[model samples]
Target: MKKSYPFLVLVFFSSCWSYSQSIATSPYSLYGLGSLYESNFGLTAALGTAGIALPSEEFINNKNAASLVNIPANNFFFEIGGTGIQSSFEDNVRKENRNNFQFSHMAFAFPITARSAFNLSLMPYSSSSFKISGLKIPIIDGNNEYYYLNVIGTGGLNNLDLSYAYRLNNKLSLALSASVLFGNTTDERTYSISSSTTSIDKKVNYSGIRPILSSQYKMTSSLTFGLNVKSPTRINANKVQSVTVENGSGSSFLETDKKSDIDDFYLPLDIGVGISKSFKNKFNVTLDYEKSYWDSTNQSDMYASFSDQEKFSFGLSYQKAKTARNYFNRIKYAMGAHYDTGYLEIDNKKIDDKNLSVGVSLPLDHLSSSLYISYTYGSKGQITNSLIQENYHKLTLNLNLDGIWFVRKKLE
Candidate 1:
């Protein structure tokens, strides 16, 4: 067979240096961090992102690093995925529709030794590209008088992870990883009076590094438990700005490309736990729960606030057997559900999300490679006088390929 790793490498490097487009267009992206993103890998997206306790034997598990230790000996794995989202936003006044497509992730993994493995991947950490025109804001002590503001925002952040896992024995495994977070966001605002308009342009650059720890224990031959922790971090920020004003009398520049210091963004601690169980070698189920202490970060946006967040997900899969004589019987089918009490609070209302997904994994040749296709439908926020609700449909495609390494050729 032809080599697959080379194609994966090319796709990987191209994605790393490519950042000219926005990954998210949600209006809520106008808030802090521009709508933080979690890029799913392998079968995780189809499994409602509940793979913290899954092994890396058949595919790479990006949720928990400890899963890497399960990589089969003398085997290599590569995965590339992308997503398409169609959404409708509704409010009391009007409705809008939009569509977006973007690459999700590119990752590769391999065994380092009999009981150890390593992985490297690049994906978006967050994205924001939004427009708000004629947003009326009441001026302080203005007695019901308000000013209309027009704003546009764009940009996001990217994350690069270096992970290593080691299996202490057949029942327990541990892993550690460090991730680099870097990116920038830009915003342009314009406010107008009867004869004059003022514009302010600002760009913020951010950079930081966070470390993660993960563990997995095989409680029984059919059950596995897992945990992962992400330490709190501070991302340094610098702002570049310019301001201009125009009136009937004249047009003038108040500032031009001015650089200044700003308060750094602080990410709160995050923790998660999960379990995976198998029954009769044919069916499997996985469940996960997670929490983020955003309230502790004490961060607030001009229009929103942060709060503690909670999330839960579960998945069920069916497969006749990995070695089933019939190709159809060997195919894997899965379905899952997810809920998240989002961290952002706008207008004193928490923006929450819920979704369901179904997928099928089609085996390729006799090797442990497969193609994954999944569909997800979800909604976020609630429709009210001050807030808009978003309903979205997402489709994901993942190409997972495998190869054998360090094997001596017999006929070549």
Candidate 2:
């Protein structure tokens, strides 16, 4: 098992590279930074992505870095996970279906000392993949004529984070983390008229950094409270554009090439709070609330306006204490739900999302390594005012491995 660790890591990274190429598919992704991805993974995801205040000795909780201090000394925790989405979209006129599978996240956590812990992770910050077409307009050029326009967009961003957590006392823990965000997106628009076609391609590149502060308090043995804050960030933006025209005889020619600087993109401050309680080690429940002050930024994209965003989450888990008995008794079952008033507003309507999820975790070996699987069913937006409504089902898979990374050797 020790020798296979290197090979496993290599395979995991390679798979991540391949899957990252296409992470999401949604028409709503055409706006802003694309579809914002959830940060939950593994056990947290199984618990309905509501683990901010939950503490675990056997798992790594990325939601609240302060929880890292709860990990047992000398134990190294690693997680790799991915998601598969099946989605259907509909408007008043028509419906369409799309599906995607992609890597979700990878992380590692270990104790730096008895009082401090360290964690590092990589995950998608957002994803954009959408195509829109069938836009027809009449031209009154002496003779009545019609033209069509089609638009396609793709790409997204990724985040790399490094965090540290310290146990300040018996009841309180604190954490700080920094993340580097980077990505590129491409948008192409094509116009068709009179057997000739013209296309314009625009590409935007983004890079930024943000800092987060987190804290967890053990109010009592059965109850805990957590809070986190992310500061606002400014992302530098640059654009490269090109235009091409194709004639009726199938000859294509470049029309223009340009590079320019765009306005700096702004991200708003985000705050989250959560609480969790355990019932006799058999049942656990958690509740969480988060808000982003997008309205404070006063930012707007070309097609959509920004609104303050809020999310509420709830989760429950059940498991039997380990005993020399059936294997099923050791498995954990979890369920959760969440509702979000999204940040994007179009035509005086806000895009919203709601989801319900259920999951199971199967212990793999004596070291507390486990396989986690979860499913979420959700809907986003509404079919009103010619807007699209999205219904989706997502499946998540994760492998959590715990081992001893560094050990002292004794010689005779």
* True-vs-predicted CA distance for residue 291, candidate 1, Å: 0.7
In model 2, pairs of residues that clash are none
TM-score of 1: 0.92
TM-score of each: 0.92, 0.89
Per-residue alpha-carbon lDDT of candidate 1 for residues 1-412, written as tens digits (9 for 90 to 100): 1111111111111112222377677777877788888888777787888988876478889999999988888889998999988887776555667778889889999999999999998889999777666665556554686676777778999999989999999999999999899999999999986678999999999999999999999999889999999999999999999999999989899999999999999998999999999999889999999999998998888667889999999999988988888999989999999999999886678899999999988999677799988899999988765567889999999998999999998996
lDDT of 2 by residue, 140-246 (tens): 54567988767767899899999999999989999999988999889989889988888999999999999999999999999999998999999888988888888
| lDDT of residue 80 for candidate 2 | 92
Q: How many backbone clashes does candidate 1 have?
A: 0
Candidate 2: misplaced stretches above 4 Å?
1-20, 138-146, 193-196, 246-257, 322-325, 409-412
- In model 1, which runs have C-alpha deviations exceeding 4 angstroms? 1-20, 138-146
How does each model score on lDDT? 0.84, 0.82
